[model samples]
Target: MEIAIGVVVGAILAIAGFILGRSSGRSVGLSEGPLAGSPETDDHAALEDRSSSRESELNTVLVEAIGRVSAFLKTNVRKPLIEAGEAAGADELRERIEHALGALSDIDFFLEEPSMSRSGQSLVSLVENVAQEFSGDQDVRLRMQLASSPVRAVVSGPVMMDVLYLILHNASRFGGDSTIDIAVQAIDGRSLILVRDHGPGFSDEALQRAFDPFYSTSAEGLGLGLPHARSLIEQMGGQIELRNVSDGGAEVEVSFPSS
Candidate 1:
């Protein structure tokens, strides 16, 4: 199933590249179609038109792919994974399902160019949800330090929730024998959330490439978690930063601009 999904994703990425290549005049034939034998100015004009059309076509392809992937995850992956886990009484099955769900969340945010509506969402509620989702199995302990007052951020609640989940998931996965700590506060009219784990601090290489897509320290990971979190936060007018604490841990700080 994983291989099948990888092939499908690879094909979609190739199609996207091909579309962009044609738009940029690399794959557009100069001697065959509308630009054939045309003067320089005419060729330029035609190319511009093709580029505009190609952009629209590319958006259509991305939207379609998003729909197909969402449907596939719901119908094929989620149900079977849940049932198998229940039948076999294995925690690993549930963990795999959660990881798959996280991947779907990333794809949903990374594609779909238009941002979702997230006006007037309570930061307090968002933080609560994130804590709940990550600790769903009741095994991982999360220490949430929330601010006293209500905090609101100008970002989609779901997007922020996923961001928190990704951060917490990473902290727990690498934390090993240490408890995870999360702090949520409002300062200077912005909502700030910090995640700290008492694990071995990131090495120099990790600090440089931690947020790069497909670059993972773990052999089994796809390395899209931090990248996806960063993209989603920036899209919503927020900022994310990662650093190692001086004492002994890795820290992730997320700031959402006030609505």
Candidate 2:
């Protein structure tokens, strides 16, 4: 009876030791082993991804909203100011205003239509006619060199008009009562318009920043003119660039893909 009781006690001790060792090994493995996917970790990763995506979407929406607002102000407020200036007996100012307004109107009209075809001849003629109408007393001279052959392009009329007017307006504004040389040429299978103004040229940084939305050097300017012009040109598969001439002025070059 004594031996049997000792044997039973020893057996019970061995069993307990084995269970304790197994339990310790399992705890250590759980602490040092490769991580297993859990609901909590998965939820955290998903939340982070969602947050990043939401932030990106919100930024996009904000940028688009800013653009729309800028457009509205340019059309409704800025253009009207030009018209009002014209009526206020400022002949030079009036001419500038009319030029700007006409360009804005053309852009508005062109964008209002969905499917529109534009004739290169008609566009060139329209621009020349408008320029002549507005160049009455301004010291700056207006000139147009149309292509020998009509360079047909698929464009929204108003958009192209706005682009042209913007370039012309900028040239006149900065040219400081000097003659502006306007020329049109065809190069590299693209129709190109060059507007050169004898004004204080901008630095490389300023030239680059001019394309940014709402960037302006003039305290009175709303700074949407160039950006809007660029948007219109790019919409029609064209490009606009500003470069300082070696003499002492700035030149704006616009290129349109040949249709």
Candidate 3:
């Protein structure tokens, strides 16, 4: 009987030892499993996050491009069509549409990335060319005095075009019988371009507030042209100022640092 009891006890101790060893082995395996897979899983998750961020950035750029295109179409193409439909002569309408499209194309070209400063010089040339084109027909003469020596500066092509367009348009529209003059010169180690129009001059107060965003004297203006020009000039580390001449005119002076 005693020998049998001792045998039973020994058997129970062996069984308990086996179960404890199995449990310890399972605990050790579980601890190492996550450690073995964690690095790869973390790497995959990081890649996914980066991909998502890139997609979002791409979408934002696409949306901006689409919006600009839509705006151009609406303003240059659609609005003109609607307005011209009610007018008497189709010739005037056609001319207006052509001019609008040309201006819009110029704006689009300038606003694209990889902006070339040469584009600004090209724009000045284009303005002179246009003036020469209509020089014989128009009563108000346009004159350009570009720098004999190249005046190179880092500037956004589109914004420069806009500035030129606004100044020229204003000059042509309001310059009664006087000729519009443009002079590009170097001043204080910077490039200074001045557009002078012999139109009704503005008050000193107006000159001070002229560059403020959304400020305009014209009832029909979008009140963005001058302000936008100023903003762009400032962005390129330049400055613009407006002044009234004693000879009944206004002058827009744009200054840019040499590249």
Candidate 4:
């Protein structure tokens, strides 16, 4: 299954590159159908139109591929790996695999273009469910300050769960052995989820490019967590912010369109 996944992902990546090559006005010498002629032969307007369409298609491919692949790894690979750690070396290997699996989530977010549809899930309940996973299966201690009132957001429940997972995952991974703090608030027209971690906090450079793809402070990661989170949130008609708290640690606030 792993080998099959690799081959499939590799082929999709190659196709994405081919589409990218065409979109960027560099042909890979494919002499077939719409890809036969060089850009110079086409009128300026037609070239722009075709390139735009190809780019859109490429984004769709990326979003679909990453989502499906990530889901498969989570169920088939990550769960077993997490459950079978009997040695220090095995733990290290599991950590590395987690980082790779995490990259897929980030890439999926970066490629997602439009806002996700609301699945009519209660915001408070959805967050609590995700929090339970973190505290139980992941063994990450969490302190929750949930809202007294139930709120509904205009966002997809599954995607929002992924977003919350990435946020909490980053907090736990970087926050060392400290307990992460979480809060949900509904105020005015927005519903917010705030997560704080008692880590060393972001360096000056991290604060600047924390949302840039493939930018990671740790060597084990591809650094797509925050970038993907931010991109995915923004695309969902929500806003994500990162900052260092006054005393210590990092704080992330994600606000969604709420009723």
Candidate 2 residue-wise lDDT, 1-259, digit = tens: 2432343344334334433443343223223333457656665555556656655654564454345444544664466565564246677666656665554443343233244355454445546755775476355677666777655556777667667776777677666646787777767788777888888887677787887544556543445567678877787788888899998888888878765
| Candidate 2 lDDT score relative to the true structure | 0.62
Ranking by TM-score: 1, 4, 2, 3
Encode model 1's per-residue lDDT on 73-177: one tens digit a residue: 655556556566445645777676676666555554454445568787888788888788778843688888988887788888777787888888888887663
List the lowest-lDDT window of 10 residues for candidate 1: 106-115
**RMSD of each candidate relative to the true structure:** 8.5, 25.4, 26.1, 8.8
Residue 191 shift from truth in candidate 4, angstroms: 0.6
Comparing 1 and 4 on TM-score, the stronger one: 1
Over the full model, what C-alpha lDDT does candidate 3 score relative to the true structure? 0.60
Question: Between prediction 2 and prediction 3, which has the larger TM-score?
Answer: 2
Candidate 3: which pairs clash? none
Cα TM-score of candidate 2: 0.55
Q: Rate residue 147 of model 2 by lDDT.
A: 70
Report the Cα lDDT for residue 156, model 1.
82
TM-scores of all predicted structures: 0.63, 0.55, 0.51, 0.62
- Between prediction 3 and prediction 4, the one with superior lDDT is 4
**Candidate 2: worst 10 consecutive residues by lDDT?**
25-34
Off by over 4 Å in 1: 1-7, 10-115
